[model samples]
Target: MTIHTTSSCTAFEGVRRIASGALRDVAAAVKRAHDRAGGEPILVFDDATSSPIEFDLRGGVDDVLARLADAAANGAGAAGQDDEPAAARSRGRPKLGVIAREVTLLPRHWEWLNAQPGGASVALRKLVDAARLARADNERVRLAQEAVYRFMTAMGGNLPDYEEATRALYANDRARFEQMIAGWPGDIREHAAKLAAAAFCEVT
Candidate 1:
């Protein structure tokens, strides 16, 4: 059974956005754009991580999409696209999708962990989940910034204030970031800001 993996994708022809939607639709749009009279430099990106999608559009649109489906079925998808997790049998709750892995702890730490209500594994999982909850806001900011940086490096590298805009992005200076990107290509600026919007929501 082919497990369908869905990912949000966007394509830009030069500095203008040509399409934004599911991977299949974006791939079709990209192929059509690339086949135009004057072929433009079209790049499809995974919105989650701002990583480029390299499609082999050698044959017709159906052929291109077929290759993508085949890759997804084999768990060999382009980086940055979210994929359904593959099932793996291991020494723990495989039904719960848990895979056992070796974890090392100091003797004192191990002793403390082993004494917890449900032993080390359950205790460790609880600790990890709690930590994630605590760091959720900061984690979102970090991920958003990373995605913005990737898009900037790919599309805005040669824009006038690229370096300053990037610095402002990381520094959480919204005003400065806006000013720095003021002179950039319109679509690039808008898309970069869109990717970074969530990061700044918790800035204050």
Candidate 2:
């Protein structure tokens, strides 16, 4: 049977043809997709039904399963790997695997880190990471607040003091703090939460 595939940002659409008798003999093709990709593989039974017929990709399915299998794997998009940190899932809680070395920073450099919110008790790595994370987070907060403002504007309301309101939420206003997701997409909430956790070293 001849097989053809076309791909989109998150989907792979394809078709295969086989002898009517061979329709019951698709064990090898499923094995191929499973070996190449580590996830559940799908098969389409009929062109009219968009949903895939579930098959165990761990082994193989029969030839009858071949033509019927329309696989749709959600391909990871253009977000580069570096766009996020690796998963830190482990038992208990994720630990920061930090290796420390003593360095003689100039008095000025030492003073700078010592003046941070955590003060000198904070590790140098933590201070630097916190600074970087704070910068990125501030940008995200701004974008989120802007989204909220845009939403409000759509309702014929005006947002006053965008920066002041954002700062208030980030600091003293817990109610607004919990509700300031401006223009952020839904998928990024988990990522943003994770980043916030890692930055603050807080357990959610």
Candidate 3:
């Protein structure tokens, strides 16, 4: 199994966003900025999730690149073929970390579930998977909105029309949000727009 990790990150020096891209790329940019002015505080945030990214900053850009490559290789090698006995694996669920918990349901509901082709567990899993698929788009939009809100709260709280911009953001009013943030500093406005891009696109 191949494990994929997020690639997007943004580096900010004070309120100015210096770079935005893959983790390694942003790390490189941060190094350059740090070299130009020693001791200036720099922060890197995951662009998609609006969370801080921490990495070893003791070395140079080349070191950071090597570490990133090593991480990628390790992730790929982490999940190899399982060597457990087939019969033992088949005896119960495939060690998917399933937990047994008591659930209370009406007699009619239990009856309906028990009558399903694969019984209750399989039927419930299928139903859940189907529901997740159906709601995938909405879930994506909601998460994007939440990420944007988090970034805005951390970085743009003091900007003009902050409250109105937040209201428009939650209201899914793209035009209004854009108008409200029009007077913001270029860097802040651009970063906020980038964070909210997906959420705003879902407004239609």
Best by lDDT: 1
Give the alpha carbon lDDT tens digit for every residue of 175-198 in model 2: 443354343343232222222332
lDDT agreement with native, every candidate: 0.84, 0.39, 0.80
Per-residue CA lDDT of model 3 for 11-109, tens digit only, reads 888778899888778878887788785545787777888877766655888987777777778876766556787776556455768778897999998
Provide the RMSD of all predictions against the true structure, rounded to 1 decimal.
Answer: 7.6, 17.0, 6.8
Q: Measure candidate 1: CA RMSD.
A: 7.6
**Candidate 1 TM-score versus the reference:** 0.69
**Highest-TM-score candidate:** 1
Candidate number that wins on lDDT, 2 or 3:
3
The count of residue-pair clashes in candidate 2 stands at 16
Worst 10 residues of 3 by lDDT: 1-10
- Residue pairs that clash (backbone atoms under 3 angstroms), model 1: none
Candidate 1 ranges beyond 4 A from true positions: 1-6, 76-132
lDDT for residue 195 in candidate 1, whole number 0-100: 93
Error of 2 at 82 (Å): 15
lDDT of 1 at 103: 94
